[model samples]
Target: MTEVFFYHLQSQPLEAALPTLVERSLERGWRAVVQMSSPERLSALDAHFWTFRDDSFLPHAPASEKGAADQPVLLTTDEQNLNGAAIRFLIDGALLPADSANYQRIVLMFDGNDDDAAAAARDQWKVAKAAGHTVTYWQQDPAGRWQQKA
Candidate 1:
């Protein structure tokens, strides 16, 4: 069975979540992929040795040098390339499909402020539930702790 984990990035930046997810995936020995829409943010991840491109799929490797095999693969889209090998794609709150078979699990991470984001999160939750996939919605407090409110 595939598992999907969704996290909202309203309280914290996606940068903060990346390392945590990578660490968790490594610990659990699970194959994981991450996708995002921000070029600047993607560049930042590239500096940290995360892979970014469209033609290739790279796994997350914390110890690899720049352009090494042991790096997290990241893909940047500009309307031309909308999707990559991402099992889960972290998108803006307003845009995401509620029902998707792209992967076994789908995670929705967003801030609580945006109304569209909230709506999408709820919709994704409903879809995942209906499809029998694991759905998780988390909110971060001022103290920087992720509390699973939903």
Candidate 2:
């Protein structure tokens, strides 16, 4: 069964947190696809990944780029998993795809400060649970560390 994780962003924004998660995914030898709600967000992330850190940048490419399947991390605004990733990261209000379970893990990150985002995460949580996936929820603490809440 797929393992679903819900990350509620409170102290840190998605931009501040995503790179670490993607890096960890890569360290685990897992390819990841980050699904965004819009092309603009995907574009922003594409640039951010290059300069997110002062010393190192995450190795990734947009799904439209050549050899997308060869990228360790793929950025996109579509439901298709062009990279055959082991994990999928859904952010910026991207809806969970019908074939979410196709991946080994599904990460749903939402802004905890936004009511709509929180509500959407709740709905997704219910759906994931109902679908029989192992679901867990994590919330950022005051210091920006994630603490499992449920």
Candidate 3:
């Protein structure tokens, strides 16, 4: 069974939150596929990853990039895990994979302040639970720390 994690972003935006989470996934020696809501977002995230930190080098590239399967992180606009990633980072309310078993963990990050995003997360959480996946919700506390709420 795939472990589904809902990260409700309240204190940080996607640009501010994604890099660290992706980095952690890499630290654990797990490849990651990050799918954004739109192609525009995918391009933006590709640039964001390059410049997120001056000294940090996140081994990532766009899905269309050459030799993408060799990268530790791959950015795309769909559920296809180009890099054989065990972790899937779905940002901007992207849809979950129909067969989530392909991933060891699926992290859905949605903005808490966005009404549509919040509703989508809630709906997905219910669907994931009904499907027998282990679903956990983590909300950001006032201090910007993640606290598991459900």
TM-score of 1: 0.59
Candidate 3 residues 19-120, lDDT tens each? Answer: 999999999999999988798888888888889999986889888888998999999887778789999998887888886888899999999888999999
lDDT of candidate 1 at residue 56, scale 0 to 100: 33
Superposed model 3: Cα runs more than 4 Å off: none
Compared with the true structure, model 3 gives a TM-score of: 0.96
Per residue, candidate 2 scores C-alpha lDDT tens digits across 42-147 of: 8999999999999999989999999888889999998878888999999988877899879999999999889999999999888899999999999999999999
Each candidate structure's TM-score, on Cα atoms with residue i matched to residue i, is 0.59, 0.97, 0.96
Q: Best-fitting candidate, measured by lDDT?
A: 2
Task: Give the poorly placed runs of model 1, Cα more than 4 Å off.
Answer: 38-41, 48-89, 93-105
Worst 10 residues of 3 by lDDT: 74-83
Q: After superposition, how far is residue 45 of candidate 2 from its true place, in Å?
A: 0.2
lDDT of 1 by residue, 77-112 (tens): 222212233344455542334435555554556666
Error of 2 at 108 (Å): 0.3
